[model samples]
Target: MRKRSIAAGLLTGVGSFVLATAAQAQASAPDTQSDGGAAANSQSEALTAEAGGDIVVTAQKRAERLQDVPVSITAFTGETLARAQIQSATEIARQAPNFRVSVLGNEDQPKFSIRGVSTSDFNLNTASPTGVFYDEVYVASQALGGSSLFDVERIEVLRGPQGTLFGKNTTGGAVSIITRAPSMAADVGGYLNLQAGNNDYFHADGALDVPLVQDRLGVRVAFTASTSKGWIDNVTGRDLSTISSNALRFSAKYQDDADFTATLRIGRSRSNPTNIGPIVNGFGPGGVSSTGVNPRINPLTGQPLGQRQGAYNVIGEIRAYGDNANLTLTKGLGDLTLTSITSVIKGQFLNTVDVDGTNLDALQINFADHSKEYSQDLRLSSDFSGPFDFTAGLYYFKDIADIDTDYFIAGHSFTLAQSYRQTRTSYAAYADATLEFAEGSTLYGGLRYTSDHGRLKRFEVVPTIALQPTLKYNDAKPSGRIGLRQKFTNDIMAYAQFSRGYRSSGFNGGALNSAADITVARPEFLNSYEAGIKSQLFDRKLTLNLSAFHYDYRDQQFINVVTVTSVGLVNAGRSKIDGLEAEVILRPAAGLSINAGLGLLDARYTQLVLNGVDLSGNRMIEAPKSTVNFGLDYTAPIGNGDIAFHVDGTAIGKVFFSAQNNQDQAGALFDLNARLSYKASAGWSVGLWAKNLTNNSVVTGAVSVDAISQFTTMPFPRRYGLEVGFAF
Candidate 1:
């Protein structure tokens, strides 16, 4: 009955969305930038002359040339992704500067960070320190953060506190994705790509765009499906590694004239049997056993242990899982535009696993999570192109989540069921403008007033704990970017900018244990100062951009691991973080480019009381002091097609993995990825790609109490693949 009700609700919601789309279409105008004219022509030239194109980004809610932006950013075009073999958000982190993504027991709850500042917990109730946006719409849940790379035009990674333009938990940075819009012309073109690699990996993706009504309405649909055999053997013959996923997206647009346009998009993704491998000891050096003993053996049966051989197998065995539904609409209102995105995202994740792999008599555990999110946003901006430009907007979001976990220790069974419902409503009004003061100088300023209210209700069945918490926060922050640019000789420009950002505080659901139902925390604030230079030489064939930035952070929110109690999770203390970063992009030759970025972080606890003693001098956990990223790509013409070679590397400097600031174990690690592609015909191509080419063992985390220490490493071995594709 419950399943049926959910299905009915979904159908009704979609029906309403369709009606809204139709109504908006009737009141909208046409888009003037759809043809292959000035904008398109310029974009094409930019893509060919450089690795991708001279991207135009709305980082400040105003369209500006990417090169002209003084902030530290990494942008990738769809074509660049195809050449680099970057298919997912996790893959993008490997190449982007000062970025790292890691999963914590749950695949759906991954931690994302830039420049060593990140959220340390995987609780659904806590807002992510890093903000993720799709087509200008914010995705509020981590389950929906990983987007399918289909029909996407470009992705922009803005590294820094973007709280002013993005709003909310953007203490670290923001990731923006732009998808391809529908075309009104009758012409149709698409591409089919297939890839096969080691571990029986297979992937396929394609898209189709059709003009339903010539010059008035159009629709575009795309799909991606992939499967990969388990890479690691369980030794017991049980499959321990495997992954399969499928996604579909549809977009429709109607244009009436050059001033009004309406568009709607819906998308869904499903995956069967996702893998979160069992814990293993000796997987790398400095590793420790999670269960208790190493080389876990069956004590009762004297038989070899199965897949669950180690301690604390949080991610046991995958049963089945899927994510569904997203709807978005955009309307042009005369000189202003409004976008409303109503998304009903749902997922079911099940896992059954053996906690202790060595004991023939084992402990079995099962886990499941069901969640939904709804959000609305409205914005207004002027279309005038002059010395001054501006924008304003408002947003609201709500979410309901449920988690069920059962653990069976031999014959005894323990179950933990939690139902969490949270509502967040935010009213924000913001405006930004750029004033041209001289021939090559401009002034920018922005102001925002945001009021937020939230309520959380949580119920835990196992321990019989019911907790309710409510919060009200209001802040009026005025952020201005005063940048001065001087044209040294018409081809070179020097600039400097200063901006301030903030992130509000809220309840920490993960910290709600039996002993403590609530923990009071404060908001985090950041002030950034930066200076840079942008220059073009050799008749625009060579481009170089350099920037240096320093960030001052206060009242940073962090999670502290505490002993589990009957009531709920507990918090240890609070901390502060500050850092500096440098980025450089150089295009010394046409069709050849090199991008390098370096970050230096000094993060420590301002006040940590452990054992009734203040430990304010301790360093932050999992935050490396130094990190670097480098990329080199080269392409050459070969018969009607092109041959390209690309290489990229990421290096992380040594740092303490725990707040204790221990230096007994520290090491620097690096990873290298390379790819080569060749065109076989006018519409066909083939490529070979390899990742983790050196198979270097890198420790991502460690735990230590007193003198005993335990370490965890990802150790993703070398993987290689071959891909073939055709376009027409």
Candidate 2:
């Protein structure tokens, strides 16, 4: 059935292309550029825009055309993000193939999975296997996870293992966010946008670029402030999903056309959002009550609440705040360019949940944490004209976090408090190079050596629990990549690669029942083999990329639920993942653009034995077997302005939130988005946008408590809004 659906989609795309071609016979060439950013560039922006010139990227720690990189990546330009109203990480995941995000009870923290690799444990101190880097600085804590999409320059999603260049915690893949730099172009330019929508949603974000000294020094300031009454209607009074957040970034850059450049950035963000309680499934392992009905009943219906509506006595809330600073310097010394990047981040997060989702106050949980991180990366890149070119770098990272959690159960009759401090330090060195062996054939490979150290101290549980001794862990691992590439032509390239990815070992921070629960989870490793081709055919009017990958995974980390109230990280014996991905972009006419992506995956555990249970062959959590996305955009000149319309839809296959893969613990999702806008030649625009047009909602993640009930988390329901913007 999935194959048939894919074929039908292709046929539909061809039909649309033929119709677009017929219409172009009577129209002149329309402006194909859809950029609305102050830092706009003339190139193919994203999957939703026309395929035109080259897109420059730094996927390999060096600037190169996207088409030239051998890795599988999906990138979005600032203009494309604005046009699509993609303001959150989950929204971006919806547009990318083979990528998924699961939001836990806390709305701000989202776990990312790429190519069937992910971490399911919701431990605040544990870093995600899929690393996220903001301007080359790694984000080290899940507590600091929030919206960071405003005033961005470009976003790159690299699939498969990127252990060589990215290093550490990237057994899955990497997400790189490159912010727009202060231009030294002797021009004062800026952009402002305002948006209003249903559920009392209001958003305002803008960026201003100022030239302090022409062609030398400049500054850029950007901010985003948004508030919403939220969508989830609560019977108890205030809306359940309300959100209020603000972020600001200030950047200063000094550059000499001769050889030196330095940039400094300081940013801060705060969010206080009222969380909607999870949808309550049927009774958990405890089974139904004597009445044969659910034990937890909804007051309105007198039945178990299986929907998203909330009826909480104590409203679930989260306060997440962060401050970050980064400094980068680059100097050219003959053929070698020396670069340095230093970053520091500080954050505090507090989360409270009405676990039972009832006015009865059966259960509640409070989680709070304070975290700080410091990192430095130094690199030397060569710009040699010779066949052999290389990039080498050294990296150091350290993070410290203090966690405090309180659990209230049985109508607040029993309470538990757990506190711990976790610290991690890592050091690494890596190098990569490419050599043109023959005319158009090249050999590229790199190796990275990493040393990781972890310490957990002052772990204690209140109410006369044992005082846990300080636990320490240290390990050294080597990971790398080797690939071969052939440039058949200027518009086509193919590559094959084998890469090794790694995730550091750490103590489970979620363990609170006893000292025995605080066990170390050994490092997980992956061996991936991949082959792909990239081509621009039909006179650059069509772009297609295809890749196939297989992974031999060992010691896969998974959450082991010992009981309702206790959980820890344990390594599954083994697993395997096979995947195929394809991306197509077509410019059927002057102002018509279409894009489609297909991802097919088969990921499952090959061997597993937990407590005398042979639980092998289970599908990996959030590892959907099939995914598809299609996008269409059309623009036509009307008088002195242009009217553009865009619509896109994504279909995600069924996914399980637990390793057990229960029938009721899985669901699928399909989302549709559309935007209609008019851009005047005077640099002002207005648009109408709608997301989740069908109001589709399904369970994306869930947790089952022993003797309790299953709690599920869902995506935002539906939203439609109007936006006004001006750029100069």
Candidate 3:
């Protein structure tokens, strides 16, 4: 059935191209001299009207107007990111709607999700549901997980499935990070930022951009350091605090603009001991301490219960180092243009943490992981006006990683190590063409053919038990999209599209225990149908976008609790999710803006049976039913300076934490930030800022374990600070 669908899609795509060509040939020929001048002027006008100045994006592997794209996307400029103080991917999560980011015990490992579809496993060998891309190159492993936001030009977040254009492993969505290119002009500028707040917190960041050669080469360097005192106290009278991190980044680029460009980047970061405070019972409902004792105790009685000092003992530390290099060559051949990108990246991380907190007795665990990735992509696109616009690309990726760990638990000590190597080679050919049937209406169709091959190996070791397993998987998926856009008026447009996406499967890292290990699962598939509208009102000052979508998911994979000896992860049954989303951006006046978004989701299991019991009506775990986000920002001119006020808030409705759909949790939180700045001169400024004015203690996440029947809660404390900066 899948093969037939692919064949039909290809036929339809080709037929559309043929019809468009015939129609173009029958129409009156355009005047080359006069029409060419008018077309150039129109393009210039369009670029001038872009949001934030003329910005170029490579969403389709070519520079194009963002407004002209048919997909729903959000683009953040470098200035905007700096104003919002977004330093990492985890911070970006707070601003995007229906998206969440989290880190496990290891700061070097990160998990990302969009619209409630995510992989929560912390294993080093598993693939993420959402894909991460840097300068069009994919990051291979979690060891290269968190990226520093230094000298970045822009970040594009494409919502929904992007399998048709981005290829495999992107069933949920994709994030693209575009770095700033070196400038040829001999100009130098830099910024220094210092922040200090409660909890003995301090942060400093600096950057310098310089032109190495006159209109030929350039270099940029950036560094960051931060430290904070712990808010939680330990019973052992030890200080559980975090030390400052030292991070440095350097970038060098050479460009002559003819046909070739080369760039190289190197970065190193080291983090001091990060304290994971003692587990306190009663913080959440039905919580108990690890030592099996009451959480709430009288400070003067009960043998002091531990010492209520503001610190815990040192647990572990992490250090990360990475290097990346890329070269791009572009040349025009007849009516077609060929472009090639070759890149290599290598990264290493070292993590050491104390598994258990104790004064006289201590338990510690150390982990070291490293990874290397190399890729090459070649693309050919046509610029000739032949009633067809198309692009084709070839991609190759290879990765190898190793992990070593030493575990110590009181009287027992053990060492375990594992290694993984994977080589994924994909060949994809995709093309999209638009048929101008009449004035203000067009038909668009696209098809993509992708072939992938992957191999994995795992080795486990113990004094008494040792096991090794090897697995290889291959798949060929063809995805297509057909859509129509009709311009009803000058300011209103409507669109409808049908698209398909797939996610490859691999080993389950969360199922690996010292005593038992389970087999891997297979890949999953998704089909989505969507329709939307875009409107501009009040003289283009207010914009509204609304979309509704339905998705059919098959062979959903999840972690299940079997018997104590056989607990592991597996591929579960199928499910369905349908939802609606709306976004509104209003610019009432100069220097003032309001943005709001809302999402409503309905997700449930369609066919799920376990242990002779039907589990069909269960709501998806950790998936919220509704979410809301709102923000207000205004900047006003003052005497020789400008003052800004901003407020943003997020609200998540009730959600179930478990598969049984019994536990319900909900919350709403608000964050307010304001700054008053005085411009000292042409290149310097000073500001006073305040954050979390409400000082509300909000819960961020919660989890419940079936083995112990205990729940754990994580909360974020309020913080406020002041800063000074300079720009030239």
Candidate 4:
């Protein structure tokens, strides 16, 4: 009760402060800059003749202003992301609302969840509710998606279910990345960025663009490399938190004629990192023999501890590699256009860790996976001058994966292995249409049909139990959405949307003692409804967006560890989520900006009964009641150079790890990041940055093994660095 009260008070205080500041800015800004009563006609209206307040986005498959889109989205450009010190997708949670990323085996592999709907399952054949895409191509492997965010042009995070346009497994939401295109201009340009930070950290990013064939062909290449020393030094012997990584991307474009254009891109990435340190029984001194609930005390802070430096030691590491290639072709007709997309991805990773988190190596676990996927899409879009417009597309995806797990036990020196191969083939068809019957009002609807076939083979079962050598499953689903939007004024817009989304069913492929537990996992679905309003006040100097949403989810899939090397999925019962979110962007003066977001989520399991026990009314996993984000950016001109400063923070309320709603199964956390920079007149810049400035110990996730052991992971350590960059 004390923790919850403190968290609520802090969030309310911060939100109130930010709102007051925005109100003051609104009262002060003069409305001299004329909008000329001209509002944007489409959602992707790139630029306007007015001030630089409105942003353009392509969230609806067409160009439109942010305020005109019916869905909720938060977009960041390359420059903005860099300035915010956000290099990976996992860091996006610090700036967005109702979004979180949980790191798994290593930093390269992350599980993304939105609005309390996400996955903890690590099966190769299962898909994530939150879809991740690069350059419009879906990347199925979590081990490969993180590298794609490094050289992106823009990232768009859609808040609600984007099932219709995205097609499959997008019941929670979708993250879309658009990479920078190759320029056809007869010019050579590029950039170089280098950094040195605490903990012996070093990083380098470089890019080069060239016009190969004057006005017809062009190429661009970009690469990044980084290394960091371990943060946790094992008292017993070796260190457990080092990192090394490298990634490269090459792109080319051909536009020989006005009607035909094609672009191709290829990327590769590799990383090696020692295992992150885990504390002993994060929920306290509880054990299998004696279940005593005592919070693990941090040796450094003496507070309820998380995973960090400890007396015990273990030896383990992670090696991961990924490669992806994509090609897109577009052809223009008199009043319609045809497009084709081809994509291929391959990922391989090996990770090992000590299960006990103690010097006495009771159990050690190893997991390895190799995956390959191919996809193709064909679509046609009409540019009709009439009141009605539409777009239709067909997509096909194929995936193959091989996975292996090993469990090593001490004392008797016994080893166990669970190996399997999995494959999936999916096909989908979708169409979306819009009708503009009035000048400023529109009605839009979409539908998608998807079919998936999955199989698991070459299984190794428990020594005492007999299991099937092969398993196969097939499933089909239909998902879609409908929405209406109306422009009340030149600066005000309102919208309402309803959607249905689904996740595919598949084989669990676990080496469970019970054959029925590992045989199958059912599909899940969501019925979502949302309403929102977007407005620009004080002559576009202040922008505010507010939304309310409700989700009805059924057949939620839950995973529980059966052993150190294997886990089984359970079809947990129905759940419901109700949430409200608001964002404020205000510019009180030139070169000074402030932004803040508040999210309130209420999620609970409505009906869950197992073993004749009612487990309903429990809080949803990974869902926080209140999440608040606030930030500020200030820039001013000095004598010979300009100085800029930025500071931001994110706070999350209590989050539960399981559906049982045990008091000890929850935690709260916060983080702070800041930077200061100076720019010269010749396109050169230098900056000093800090992350986790307070060095506050916070837990991001925790899981309990029965009533015996609880494992917890923490946020990054305090890191301060100096950086230099040059642009052409």
Which candidate achieves the best lDDT against the true structure? 2
- In candidate 4, which residue pairs get closer than 3 Å at backbone N, Cα or C atoms, i.e. clash? 42-64, 43-64, 43-65, 44-63, 44-64, 44-65, 45-64, 284-294
Ranked candidates, highest TM-score first? 2, 4, 3, 1
lDDT tens digits by residue: candidate 4, 35-130: 112221221112322245656666766556677778888877776678788877778888888888776455677778789988767655567888
lDDT of 1 at 306: 43
Residue lDDT tens for model 2, 1-728: 35434544543465344334433422432333211111112111112222464566677887676777899998888877877888866677867899878887544687889988988887777878899888888998886754558888888899998999999899999988888888756689999999999888999999999999997899999999888885665666676767788899998988787778888899999888886666655563444422233535666777554355766676767888999999988888877888889999999988887666566667788989999999999988887777888889899999999999898977778988889899999999999998888976889999999999999999988863567788999989999999998866565677899999999997887776777888998999999988887766665677777887888999888787655468888898899888888888888799888889888888888888776788799887779998898888899999889999999999989988777787435566789999999999999999999999978887767877554466677677788999999999
TM-score of each: 0.82, 0.92, 0.83, 0.90
**Model 1 poorest 10 in a row by lDDT:** 34-43
Off by over 4 Å in 2: 1-53, 284-297, 301-306
Please tell me which model should have the higher TM-score, number 1 or number 4: 4
What Cα-based lDDT does every candidate model obtain? 0.59, 0.79, 0.58, 0.74
Q: Write model 1 residue lDDT over 1-728, tens digit each, in one string.
A: 34334333543454344333433432341221110111111111112223223556556654556666556677887777777777767667766656777654333345677766676554555677788877666766675676567667778888877766687777678888777766667787688999898878888998888888887888888888877765444544444546677788887777676544566667777755434444433232333233344533434444544433322333345533334444444455555555545555565555554444333333454556666666666556655445555566666655665655554544454444555555556666666655656765666566666666665555443554554444334444444345665544343445666666666565655432452545535666667666555544444444455555555666666554442222122233445444444445566676787777666566666666754667786766556777788888898888888888998888877766545465323467888999999876678989999988977555444332113223232444578999898887
Question: What TM-score would candidate 1 get against the native?
Answer: 0.82
Give lDDT: candidate 4, residue 637: 91
Pairs of residues clashing in candidate 3: 235-306, 235-307, 238-311, 239-311, 239-312, 240-311, 240-312, 316-352
